[model samples]
Target: MTDKQVLPKVTKITAQKRQGRYNVFLDDHYAFPISEDVMIKFRIFKGMEIDDQLQAKILAADDVSKAYTRALAFLSGHLRTEKEIKQKLQENEIPETTIEATLKKLRGLNLVNDLQYAGSYVRTMARTSDKGPIVIRRNLRAKGVLENDIDEGLREYPEEQQVENGVEIAEKLSHRYRRDPVSKMKQKVRQGLMTKGFSGDVITQILAKTHFEMNPELEDEKLQNEFTKVWHRNRRYPFMQRKLRTKRTLYSKGFQSDDINRLLDQQVDSQ
Candidate 1:
């Protein structure tokens, strides 16, 4: 008898818990599970006759369908670069041919365009994160996006916008360092912006825009509060030793030498 003539008949098709997937039974025995896309593509149904050749085609189609489904799931929550998708499929041990077919299918549907992914990623990072263009480019490259696409994406984030974002970040940080010396505050702001991927030029522009202005009243108040605490803590020391200790403590707290000396002199005059 010919293989086609002796082929088994599908007895049932059972829906699996996973959405859009079904288990096919041949001659009352479990044959294979396939995605809805595959079922529709192959016209699979209960009572269908599946020859050995047809069964092979169905299994191959199922592999591609599963890979495509996985790719869709990966892309559902967030955009992914082509390289990222390939890596994900490889990690799942999907065959290279199947991966290629799945990716082609995705491309055909216009669902996996790197340019679109890059543009969206850049915009989201600019709006939400502190990352600069240079860092953003490197990140996109790592995700397998082409340099041209990266450049296209980065074009959306202009230098002026980066400076603005840097200034905004610096302003928020200034509140935490209000009591610190002007030099210390500027240094901290510069370092913070640098870590957030801003270039030196952008950081310079931001610092220039958000220049630190010392409030003498606030400085004096903070110094006095700090001096009182230091004084009580070093009450056991002699006056000169206590003064030296307090000056060092204030210096360590980011107060300038002049401010520390002036505050110490005021304490001595008062006592």
Candidate 2:
């Protein structure tokens, strides 16, 4: 058949209930539906003739246009890594070829930049959370950010700033544990900072700056309070057993050995 005779003539175009999409009828039979973008791109109109070649071209264009629109919608809410965007599109069952083309389009517009996404993520976490470089790096890696991008992102957080942040957190924890023995309080702060992703060196540096002054009056009060509790709990034990148990308890609680001995001597003298 000649090309003109074989071609289907567009008889009607009607808008579907879906926003910005229309159905095209050829020879009074529904042929295909296309997005407004595709219709405009190919200048599809009633009374136009479409051969098989034109029909294939239009269908391909429509697929790409739809995929691009879906991608745009996905990106509208927040920044996303390239892998995240790909996984999202795949979840929607978009064809692989269309997904690749859509990604290319997004990259061309600088909308799918992994480096930029990583930077934004790092800055947001640094500003809003107590996360250190290790934790932030792990988070970015989980989100499929590239190693180079993650490194670049971490570079934005200076070493001094990390130490400063660590010290700030340590100070807060120190206040909470103020009643505890100095060694116990420092250990608690160190462990707390470690859980928040601070490196050992940074934690050590912060701890080095921390000063736990020996308060003789306060230490005496704390020791007496602890001794009273221990005496009550172990009152039924023999004299030697109760003394040894109290010594062990106070030592484990991080009180100084000399302080424990002096307190024990005072208790013995009183008895």
Candidate 3:
């Protein structure tokens, strides 16, 4: 049509060594290569007529086909949401238009479903991980899942399961803080549960039912360790100042007043 002719005649097509790819010839010269997906989409074959516009369209479609193959590889490990797929493509520096086209293909094939993704994530984390409802919801939201889908996912997590997990977590925390007073231990457990995303009601239930009992010998040993450290550190001060400082330090550490006074008395007598 114009002085600058579109140089393509689809002279021959042949399979490449790489799976799912082929080499195409035009005007009996080596032309562009295409994926099998592109070949099928365009019905490209030997001797097919191709103008400049068709050539450009084929190249763009091939771009999407390559990105689609990459997206499928990204999805091979586990199910992913649409946002995840987009992010993967973006990470690989795929073009925006190609990314959108690939996403359309994935959706058409029912491979990317946020609703199912969220629901499955909720179920898996609730059972396998220490993450609670609030944490799991935040995680899903961070992945750009819709709020409605998040809420639907949380439906798979029951309140009874929440309470059970809360109680188990509280018991472990109580043991960890066993050297502290029971009241202080409860405070630590409550704070730990909150950090782990347990609801206030579940924490309250755990505190009400679980009994945190520290052995008397362990408490005595803990008191000795604290008393030694404080008394020695305050040795540079006056004797009276040292005694007062030691008692205050022990008391603030959840040591019983009577136990602290007895330990301080023994220390003063030893000096």
Candidate 4:
């Protein structure tokens, strides 16, 4: 038998408490170090016990690489909920144990957060469009975010504020539909707000308060102007037949039954 002594390379040892566990890193990689007593027990009874730092480093690199790759894939797209990131990692064939560990690491770093993502998403969409809580919740749920996280993220804003948001969106649409008679203009604005995902109640309340400065009475005079604005902006359909097709267009915007009937009747009278 050859006589040889094996010693750990003692590359670089750093210690910290990660997720309440003593995590040891060697040469900037994972290192698994058994207690000296355990090593002696194995050496004496198990004939010979071998410990290799290189092997530990290899395993650690694999785990690190997986977690990192998953993070990059998620960040490459829109900001993702924690659940979305985890599911993507799982779909990519990551083991359950590794997924959990990696997720924990990401959470510790504040890189994967459902609530933060949800809050930011809602805020951005609210600013850019008129989407309400229902659409926001639906989108977040599709991303696999927890309901509690979504609820909490949106809880800070009063639900009634959605009506105010609806009003703002309606105001933005006013310039486009203002020329239609008051009845048709209101219907158009109402429908546009509703389709953006605002609740019926919020849409109604907001529509009741909103008024376009350019059109005080919102009568046929303003209606014609607003219709001209939208029609001219999008020359897709022949201008001659555009008003004839406005009923369906207004419906698609989300106008209510009463609003649609009143607007159609007024348009008929005006014709």
- Against the reference, the lDDT scores of all candidates come to 0.86, 0.86, 0.87, 0.63
Clashes of each: 0, 0, 0, 8
Residues 1-271, model 3: lDDT tens digits: 6697555678888888989998889999888989998899899988787887898999999999899999989999799988889999999999999999999989899999899999999999888877778899889988989999999989998888887877778899999988777667888999898888878887788678777886788778988987899999999888888999888887887788998889777755435
- Give the Cα error of residue 27 in candidate 3, in Å: 1.6
Which residue pairs show collisions in model 2? none
Q: Estimate TM-scores for all models.
A: 0.71, 0.84, 0.84, 0.55
**Residue 81, model 3: Cα distance from true site in angstroms:** 2.7
Regions more than 4 Å wrong, model 3 = 1-7, 235-244, 258-271
Give the Cα error of residue 270 in candidate 1, in Å. 15
Report the Cα lDDT for candidate 3. Answer: 0.87
* lDDT order of candidates, top first: 3, 1, 2, 4
For candidate 2, the per-residue lDDT at 174 reads 84
Candidate 3 has its poorest 10 consecutive residues by lDDT at 262-271
- Model 1: weakest 10-residue lDDT segment is 262-271
| Per-residue lDDT over 145-196 for candidate 4, one digit per residue giving the tens place of the 0 to 100 score | 8899888767644566787777778888887875555566677787787677
Compared with the true structure, what per-residue lDDT tens digits does model 1 show for residues 66-174?
8988999999988888999999999999999999999999999998999999999999999999888878988998999999998899878989999988888898888
Q: Write the per-residue lDDT of candidate 2 for residues 205-256, one digit (tens) a residue.
A: 8888766655778877887888789866877777778888989998898788
